[model samples]
Target chain A: METRNLTCINCPMGCQLTVVTDGGEVVSVTGNTCPRGEIYARKEVTHPTRIVTSTVSVSGGVIPVVSVKTASDIPKESIQAVMDAVSGVCVNAPVSIGDVLLENIAGTGAALVATKNVAAKQL
Target chain B: MNKAGLSYYDIVIIGGGPAGLAAAISAKESGADSILVLERDRELGGILNQCIHNGFGLHTFKEELTGPEYAARFISRFHELGIDCRLNTMVLDLKAEAPSGDEGSSNGCIKTITYSSRSEGLVQITAGAVILAMGCRERPRGALNTPGYRPAGIYTAGTAQRLVNIEGCMPGRRVVILGSGDIGLIMARRMTLEGAKVLAVAEVMPYSGGLKRNIVQCLDDYGIPLLLSHTVTEIKGKERVEAVVISEVDENRRPVPGTEKEYECDTLLLSVGLLPENELSRGAGVGISPVTSGPVVSESLETSVPGVFACGNVLHVHDLVDYVSEEAAAAGKRAAEYIKGGASAGSDTPCVPVKTGNGVRYTVPSYIHPDKAGERITLRFRVGDVYRDCAICVYLNDSRIARKKARILAPGEMQEVILSGDELRSFPDLTEIKVCIEAN
Candidate 1:
């Protein structure tokens, strides 16, 4: 059995989590104030994941860029590829929050959606 | 201020950030019909608009959200509640009016807010209650007093955030961030993601002021070195940034004679500290604490000037926006109650002073009004230094009333102790309470 420690990012509490694994299988989890922390630890030690946030160019918008993030947490190792995909992306103005910009972003199975609203520039 | 330009609002929130938005929503829910939110920016959401990062809305919404998503939730809610707001409005002055001025007088004063809007020009509004949620601003290079010539490439972390996330413009390709505050650490990653090389993050304090997770994900993940007990001593640049001289400091935080290294970088970002924007608070005659550099608020979040309340970063710099929203909602509710109650605390009200004990730095709601402090009041404070395996103790007068065990405590992180009003009401002669940290 092996044990590892991780910080729960579910909330601002950032609860410290401890997970023990038995030969690549689940054993037990502790030191979490909430159940989500335990769930996070179990997945984190197995297949780590992260939500990637970035900005994409907006054409003819009130602002030059609109902030975006993955619709859900993607595999941690795929963050760089997702960013690389995001770098070449651009969308039209009047982007609303939750608007999907890239489907299956970087082939990570998570959609990249706009997080901020960007109004179209008035002529 | 002309009479024709005078408007009326039951409550006027000074800023339309997360704090102000939450306050306006709760105020409307609390039955204040006329509430106005003033935002200086082109739109609402304040700094959150520029903050595109995830890891927000954990407590309030129970889901990890990006900054804009978190703000959009509140913005939608605020809109659903039919709250009124003026965008591109800058509040120029806040003043207390109609003070009785007599000793021991409890006739709470009215508040007047003067603001300039791009559409409406300068306007003065009479407010039955004012909630200060102007938030805070980052400390500039002048605050650090570092030996440097004025250069164009130096920007505050927040400024860089806006430039990158909002304007889609990169500040520079090579960056050296000063101070390991969360903003600086986050920006180190942001600059990196935007294709800039973040050389290092230097903090004067031994420990990073940012959250442990930020240190891990932002700096450690990117392989960016965090130089603890070090700071940028000199800026060697003229027109644009050329380089920054980093030096180690001793126990007194004074630069050591021989330990210095130079980093060739085009941009320098400062995240040294944040100061609560208090010029408006001071103009309103709110008693400011030298420690928090914020208003001395009571349990009801009421400032020294009656009918005026403060919350969010304006009250004290909170690490979490969730806490700010929680506090602002309370302030809004209290302001609504103040309007409904229509009476001020007289000379008979209890002024229970809440003081800091060993290891505690300062606390909000410095005074607790036993009668008015709802069912539970969360006393938030920061510690003076780091501690492990410690206990937080609350002493009423001389008797220790409550104690909670803490695994660890740090100056960078804000801590809280919940006190029940019933507990305080039980103590009839309670004069003061002190919160302290004890080694376990």
Candidate 2:
């Protein structure tokens, strides 16, 4: 059995969570303020994931770049691969906020979509 | 319009960031017709445009949203209201109209603002009420007075954020962050995600100035070392930042002689602190709080200058954008009420000053008029240091009025207490109101 200490990120309250895992399975979770914290702790101890956010260069856009983020949380370990794939890809201008730039990025099953609108530069 | 070709607005908000946008929306909703927002940037949304990270709008919208998404919600609402605004307009100065009486210009009945843009040359405008929402700016390397030659590699965390997220440019590959402020911690993760190596983050204080969640996700998740009680002692380079000397800091925050260690790096990111950008407030003759470095306000979010209100970072640095929006919306509603000739300071009621003691640094709306406050008033303040298992106590004179248990209180997180107006009214003979922290 192993114990892990974590801070709950579900809210700004940042409740400190203590979890005990047995054979790679969450046995007990304590020190959480709410049920959401318990669920977060169980997943966090077993498989940690994060939503990767970054910017992609845009050709012929008003601004040089448009911000992008994965459609869903990807495995923490695949963050680098997702970033590497997104960095090498650039889309043309007139991109909307929800435009998907890369589908199934790094095989994480999460599409990378633009978070900001980049209007086309007037000629 | 005055002889200076001044246009007129019922409410003129100084910034178009989250604060200003929320303020304008509330002001218009409260029945103020002639509302105008002045944005210095080419577009709206202010700094949120460059902040692409999530974890925002959780409090306000009850869901996680990226910075731009959160900002776009307000922008769309602002447009829906048909509120007028000037983009790419930079405000130059704020001036009081000088009410003729010894009562002082604190209740600046009429105020003038000067701004300039490409399409419009320098222009002046008069407002019935002004909401200062200019927000705060990050402290640069010059503010630290670190011994170093001006190099090409050093950048404030915020400036670097704009470069990476907006301009799509990288500041450097190998990085040594000077402080563990939220922006610095976020940048530590950002640079690494962008394929740059973040060497380490050094904080002068014993405790991190950022949120505990950020410390875990941004640094610990990425295996970045956070050196607490440490600061950059010297910058070693001629043309660019070749290296920096990190030294452990004593309790006095002074560098220890033998604790100096060198790290080879090409870039340095400073996130020491944020100061409320209150130059315009000072120019308008608003009373400034030495502790907050922001305007001294009343319970209604009205500044010393009555009709002129302040909120967001211009009043005091807020840790969350949701709080900024919340505070600013109150400022907007109050400004609209003030414009309607309601809640005028001409009443005979005296403004009661709320005193701070024992670990509390300062409180916004330092003064309160008991009757003017609605059902309850929320007083927000920051602690001077890290505290654990303490109670936030509110006192009416020497008597304990309220006590709430606090699990943790840190300088990085803001603390707030709600004072019931009915309770204050019950103590009609109350002489002093104080807030302090006590060991539980």
Candidate 3:
């Protein structure tokens, strides 16, 4: 059995956790004060992901653009590719908050949505 | 008058941290000549030097970089612009010279700065405009009133970070960290990597104050534990830290009687909080924001006093160094404009006060000028606890100007929301802006 030391991040009590594992499966987790730490540790040791925020080009807008972010965490390694996909896309103005820009980005089941509204550029 | 001995500059910024350096660069770029930066430390990086962790620069640079790397990018530009920088100088005081009808010029601003090397005992400078960027200081154990015996192994999170990352010194063989701020969380992993056993991180708050990424990356990967609603009730040891008593806390944050548990450890690290260094600003009689504990400023980053500006951690605690540099650049550019006689054209409009309501601990830029054109106001705030699926709203006199949904909000990380001038213009008679958490 291999033992690992983890810091619980689910809450402020950064508990120094000890996870006992056999092969690839977790056996017994100790030192966690909350259930979130166990869930966090399981995901971290198996698969880790993060949410990404970036700007998308918008035409005919008062500000010429708006900021957007992924609705969910995507694969850690696929963030760059998703950013590349976002870099080439542009939306027309009159975009409102929570407007979907792209869905299932890089097959990560994450949706890119607008964070603010930008009026269409005046002719 | 000793006018011949004094060199007049358009703006003189004290400290060469990200804020001061950025201010100088902006002031110079905005066509203000005679701009000088005074840094007491030999290096220009400031607190960024001790922060060797990643997860910075996502907002401004669009790429993640280490703290020093982010600082180096700005320092390089500062050098390229040939901004006059004097290292090893400390600013003593700022005094107003004369009452000026023109509100933009800092001509009456005089600063008495002191520095001592092998040669010079002290030096001073007077300038047209002054920007306070002295940054902040970490809270120590004395402030926490920690019920513990005085021990040799207890250290602040920043001190431990400096010792380990900068000086390559090992803090201890076994560690117990108090508070779950970013520094504390990072140090837990640092000590573990250095082959030390971290017993636990105790937090008085019900939630973690650090970023979600740090929680996962620093703690989960290593199997560290976090105890919510728990705190270190007592410290045990005489000459050295040998053990700490942990207890569960109730809603009132008082330790419960029967939940006490003791763990043996050799080191205790505190990462409680940071307070802004605003003595210079206060000495100059600049109005301070109760929320930020910094200067209250308009959209142009000008403080309550004319010709004075503030930015970086001095303005408000920031989660990312990139934003600090970004905001500092704005303050720098505006200071330059003021020196060049190109300040915004208008009478000083009365500012509406902003307050923190539910869930938010505090908010920066406590005052707002609705008439300012194209000015984007950034409100930096901290939540009171750990909240998930919460909506943060900015309300102006009962009207919701902006609202954003957050998946998680922790006290450890600072949150920022920008409101454009166009939004402010919609409510011409705006009396106040109140930020509060709608749901958690």
Chain B TM-score, candidates in order: 0.97, 0.97, 0.91
Better of 2 and 3 by DockQ: 2
lDDT tens string, model 3, B288-360? 8776788887777888777788899898887667778788888888788777666642355556777788998
Name the DockQ score for candidate 2: 0.75
Worst 10 residues of 1 chain B by lDDT: B99-108
Q: List the candidate 2 regions with Cα displacement exceeding 4 Å.
A: B2-5, B99-108
lDDT of 2 at B286: 90
Sort the candidates on TM-score, descending order. Answer: 2, 1, 3
Report chain A TM-scores, every model: 0.87, 0.97, 0.79
Q: How much lDDT does each candidate structure score?
A: 0.89, 0.90, 0.76
- Where is the poorest 10-residue window by lDDT in model 2 chain B? B99-108
* Best candidate (score: lDDT): 2
Clashes of 1: 0
lDDT of 2 by residue, B1-440 (tens): 74456788989999999999999999999989999999999888988898898888888999778899889899999999999999999999998776565366345567899999999999888988999999999987778889979888999999999999988899999999999999999999999988889999999999999988789899999999999999999998989999999999999999999999999999999989999999999998999999999999899998877688999988898888999999999999999988887777654776678999899999987988887887989999999998888999999888998899987899999989999998887786877789999999
Off by over 4 Å in 3: A1-123, B1-4, B99-119, B344-347, B373-375
Please give me the total number of clashing residue pairs in predicted model 3. 24
> Per-prediction fnat values?
0.64, 0.71, 0.04
Q: Which candidate number would show the highest DockQ if scored against the true structure?
A: 2
